[model samples]
Target chain A: MLERIRIVLIGTSHPGNIGGVARAMHNMGLADLALVAPRCEVITQDSISRASGADHLLHSTQVFATIEEAVADCTLAVGASARSRTLPWPMLTPRELADRLPSECQAPSARVALVFGREDSGLTNAELQRCHAHVHIPTNADFSSLNLAAAVQVLAYECRMAWLSQTDNQQPASDPGDTVRPVTVLEADDELASHAALERYFEHLERVLVAIEFHDPDKPRQLMARLRRLYLRARPEQMEMNILRGILSATEKAAQRKHHHE
Target chain B: MLERIRIVLIGTSHPGNIGGVARAMHNMGLADLALVAPRCEVITQDSISRASGADHLLHSTQVFATIEEAVADCTLAVGASARSRTLPWPMLTPRELADRLPSECQAPSARVALVFGREDSGLTNAELQRCHAHVHIPTNADFSSLNLAAAVQVLAYECRMAWLSQTDNQQPASDPGDTVRPVTVLEADDELASHAALERYFEHLERVLVAIEFHDPDKPRQLMARLRRLYLRARPEQMEMNILRGILSATEKAAQRKHHHE
Candidate 1:
């Protein structure tokens, strides 16, 4: 699904940025590049020179007169925005965007388009409205702007990761006797939120109890949240979950015994 | 065991080679690099510039006046030599040298040294004599001579691979109920006997085998040499010796059974 996605750059001003964007795409195994009314010439010798060894990507780039034409075939259009919008149309970080692509896109022909804005002023209201979703690359609050090429690199990297995850799910069976090593990739935000969501649910329960003054204000709310991060970092397997659940049951039983004695 | 094998360089000529040697050591997870009689100035701008980010190694480098003083306390010395010596000594390849170091010198006071020679002429006969063994790097016969830095890189790489194998062997021990992994240097040739003594033992074995007509002349001497190399590569343990003896007994039993049936 990530490979099927097209990255469309709108009105890019710098020839070097065009070249760099091409190089960045090539670095992350993303080859499809579309230019929408680019301010500078994309086929200049300077652009090709800056592209280094990614001349092939530059050569195969498709040019479009408008943003709509660039993403006409795209079913899911993601507008790259640096600023938060008043009416939030599901804002996603680079990590969230990565998860949304293959995991969420059920249709095979659901063409995913990552729309990059101009180097100077970002996408206008009309331009942003064309996109199905909004994606904001997390940067320093003071200087939130990122280089055009770097932005492409991050998005391309995320797309490649998401694509790899999908492909890995389709691997053939391994032999029972073969030496196996389990590799767990660290989660990038939204994947982390599933764990955080459980923590939030616990926090809500604690809040309700606290509001009713059922528990002391000085009492610590550290127990569940502490366990959450520890277990999340460990990224325990299914069998480990059973072991933890058994331990939890034993702890509950011990607490009941103390209550009965009291 | 790798920690016991101290890598000592004598009269190093190039700063880049020093840096490259440090990088090679880093790549192999070997941090010990001792410089004796360094021609190139220690920890200079040139050395630091070439070391890139591996300047920590250059920072920790210990300088000595002579190679003898540097390796005076060492129990086992393995010298890197390019040329064949008239006076024979135990010779080992980089992999063989890696297999040799780990477990034999269990005494905390015991030190094992791997001495690399000068850029122009390799270790002198006197220097080679001080070494308990000689290590010859296998290279292209047409162009066997490798750069000083490259030779260290190759040796360090082989050492690292062996070190990783040893580490992997220890990995099962991390799990309880599993028997402790033996730390014995079984795959390394025994350093107990000196070269001349081993040669005398080999001659005696050859004479005894010939007297018994154990080998046929038509088989060629190459087969025996190949078998010797294979056994040397295995660096068999005491338990493995028993296993081999058991197999020999089984073969003899089968031969006796065939004779009785005939």
Candidate 2:
């Protein structure tokens, strides 16, 4: 499960924070790392010093052009948010995310991405919309600004915790009094849709809305964002996603036929 | 409960790590910060930068000469250790320590101190003896060395999680399905004895042991450490400590009378 966990950082300014994030990820046994349009140089003397023994991770870290490119293959992309947004989306605490990871990773192709944003501004509205969910680390209200690496450390630690719990459950229940949490094993068809699939669905949905004259692309308000939130919150299964895309395709075909008839 | 949780660092090598610790503590709503003979300067540019907005905690940080002095007033002092010891004292995962904190803090006079040792060597046996128990953060076995600030951050995050859980339990159980956990509130007489008082009892016990010829202080192998581990594990209540003190005083008096007879 830990092997399938990917850490994605977007617009990180500090080289040292990148190093710290790598070290934090390695400390918790997470390996895959992706940087989306990093503002600062990825590896440097300061980063090496901060990384200590984990500079190998920095050397091997994959850089991407955008968040979409970074997490497109991931089944679940959860963005780390430090503030409340104008648009309320589904939110989970670090522990809650951890608790859900083991079950989410049951599918062999299911990869989970824990996305972190820039040091100062966090994920933009557009960037956050790409993720399936948001995880917030509980902090003192007066001082909630966690360093980028520190945020990764918290989430990575939770991922490791969730993995440990799953491993513990795999062991035979030694103590009768212990209440073992059942891990949800996904059937082949029940696997969640990947970020790329979801993104395609959103695009298709938007085109159909425009074709039906229900949404004005030029004057779009929060219609698209709200729809994205609803669908993302639902975390459509592979079969469910297929159903949704089929319905969308049918709508598009009908719209084209209606135009031809006119 | 968080107010009662003091973070004590013993011989910290880096000023920046201390600053990071202060920030982690403040972020978790823990206020008390104590440094026991730190190797580097406590306040510096590096520390301030790492601390960000939590430098106020650094300015108000308390410095002590010894681990005993730093945690003397604390009812429960838990040391943060990375490696397993040859002589195993009681060990807890960070989560377990956090889970136990709320009930431990129910006593009005009870103050819980979290002792972290040197950045390189961790808590020494003598220093570990001074704490009631040790907390080891679970890490990747292949690469278990957590950065000093990262270690503090993990524990502090757990502390915050525990505090949040307690706070949630306090709220009215509005959901019909909510299984509310009962919070254990301690009675006044059941208040645990302070570290200062425990140190005095240990001093008295040593004197009596030497007088009765049960212990040879000159050649004491692991006698004192074992005894310290035993008593610390017991965590004697105020009344229980008084009874033990009375017994020790009586033994001393009896030994003095025998010496006069000789």
Top candidate by lDDT? 2
At residue B148, candidate 1 shows an lDDT of: 58
Worst 10 residues of 1 chain B by lDDT: B171-180
Per-residue CA lDDT of candidate 2, range B162-187, in tens? 77776453323321111233544544
Q: Is the docking of candidate 1 incorrect, acceptable, medium or high quality?
A: incorrect
Computed on alpha carbons, the lDDT of every model, listed in order, comes to: 0.59, 0.79
Q: Which has the greatest TM-score?
A: 2
TM-score against truth, every candidate? 0.36, 0.80
Residue B197: error of model 2 in Å? 0.5
Per-residue alpha-carbon lDDT of candidate 1 for residues A13-84, written as tens digits (9 for 90 to 100): 988778767766665566789999999989888678546567687889999999989999888899998865
Model 1 Cα shift for residue B162 (angstroms): 35
